[model samples]
Target: MRSFFRGVFVIFFLMTASNWASASIGCGDFLRDIASPPDTIEFVGCESEPTKQGAPLTALYRVKGKDALAAELYLDKKMGVTERMKFVCCVWEVRGETFYKDKKTGLGYHIRMGSEETIHNKREEWSKIGYFYITVVHLREPL
Candidate 1:
């Protein structure tokens, strides 16, 4: 009887612990919470990259849509989350990242963002939630 009860207790504890771990806030939550545009649109998926310290970092949880529009929406949602975390929004002169592709075979690609822009911004604006970092970007108004 004692061994049976112990097994049951262990199972219960494991179940609850796993649920709590998976319940951590993620970029998908932000994408789902926002009001959708008039037309039907769906986001590809949420992705997380590890920071220098191996902390989960979500840079741009964006949908497949107009680049400028998606960027603007991402910035807005990120700002709201940061504010809720008691952090101020850190705007930058430029906030968008660029990707480069090799011309020969179009296989190689390079991703880069402004270092000067993200340095202060990341430190000041990034909010920590259960070892995850929400990296926000400034929405540059279309010129």
Candidate 2:
């Protein structure tokens, strides 16, 4: 019993540590790759718009570089958006890079509000979405 419990604890610790390390390391890599040479990026702030659910949606971010090398992100609750009762999504644009690269890591974060059933009740229901989402962009040269 003792050995079994010890083994379980070790596995759990390793898993948790691994997850944390991965998240931070991934973000670091993302920042290094996307951030510009001088690292003089700008935070463009939030932009409000209507969501598919018909609720008010806002996106916030830090951007860098120009069109081809530029980076843009959306602000979301998981990164600390208040409200806590709406869905949130993010979009990114970078010079020479497709939107898919934005999906790589640490580019966006999301949150879902309310129960699955409640949120699914309507296509435009804001309850299924996050209250907000956060976006981040890095402008860096080739390594």
lDDT leader? 1
Off by over 4 Å in 2: 1-38, 52-97, 101-143
TM-score for each candidate, following the candidate numbering: 0.25, 0.18
- Candidate 1: which stretches are off by over 4 Å? 1-24, 27-29, 34-42, 50-54, 59-93, 96-143
lDDT of 2 by residue, 1-143 (tens): 22222222232222221122123222232323443322333333533322322111222333221211211222121123233222212211111211212335533322211221222323343323322122332222111
lDDT of 1 by residue, 11-100 (tens): 222222211222223444332343332222334344453331222323323222223233334434433221121112322222222222
Q: Provide the lDDT at 51 for model 2.
A: 31
